[model samples]
Target: MNGTEYRDHRLFKGTVTERGIIDYILSLDESLRLNYNAYQTIVFTVTHRKPNLFRSFIHEKQRGLSAKMDQALKTFRQSEIAIVNALSYDYSNGLVEGINNKIKIIKRTAHGYRNFSNFRNRIFIEYKLLETKTAA
Candidate 1:
């Protein structure tokens, strides 16, 4: 599987980073297979602030949150259609969303980290340790 990064400046807070993660998942070679006969279906999940700050403000100033969400949903749906047509497989954002939540929890519990490299290493070590414990 290949993982790349997606970045968008317009998105609130961690949106750019989250999109990067999704891009990474979508880049996996086997992610395109419909039946996943040769590979597994790739799932993309992301967790972001509930009531995205940008959206909240936009809604307050514009039609409403529902309208903003509807527009965003439509755009997302269109993007998914395009991606599915090109890849011949289904893509999911649920997993990515979950992972984002998990990351947030971890960060909060630990009271955050001083450096991104340290954070990355900690995450890697935690996963590796979990894998070892599970395998044992």
Candidate 2:
């Protein structure tokens, strides 16, 4: 899959959970070592904006501040490296954000979904449909 597609997948999300997203990201290239902290800062900022999700994932299992900090530090080190290499490239995190907004718009437009499966299908279908149109 393309970068955008790769970023949007639940498998990638799971990787973020399992291996830590920053580790996976840094593994993509060794040149990414310089700006790792910057990338982590952005990620931490975004996570703060979604406190519920953050709390649910990291803190729910009684994992305290120390564990969280260690994880964040490990992820940040690699992320800083990745961001350094990414500096020269004019990549927009906007695409992923835009896709998220589009998904919200879809849910709102359709008055929300009844179940997770349907929600997943709807999003997958919507993405595929948009991809087809763009390809054409």
Best candidate (score: lDDT): 2
Candidate 2 per-residue lDDT over residues 1-136, each given as its tens digit: 1332233446564323433565678677655633454345447645455433333333333222344455764564556545443543456689999899989988888897889877877888888853323454
Lowest summed lDDT window (length 10), candidate 1: 38-47
TM-score against truth, every candidate: 0.29, 0.30
Best by TM-score: 2
lDDT of 1: 0.48
> Over the stretch 31-114, how does candidate 1's per-residue lDDT look in tens digits?
332223211212221122222332333233232234445565456455654544444435667888987887787799889899
Model 2: worst 10 consecutive residues (lDDT sum): 55-64
lDDT, residue 14, candidate 1: 50
Give the TM-score comparing model 2 with the true structure, all chains together.
Answer: 0.30
Q: After best superposition, candidate 1 residue 131: deviation in angstroms? A: 9.5
Model 2 residue 126 CA deviation in Å: 0.7
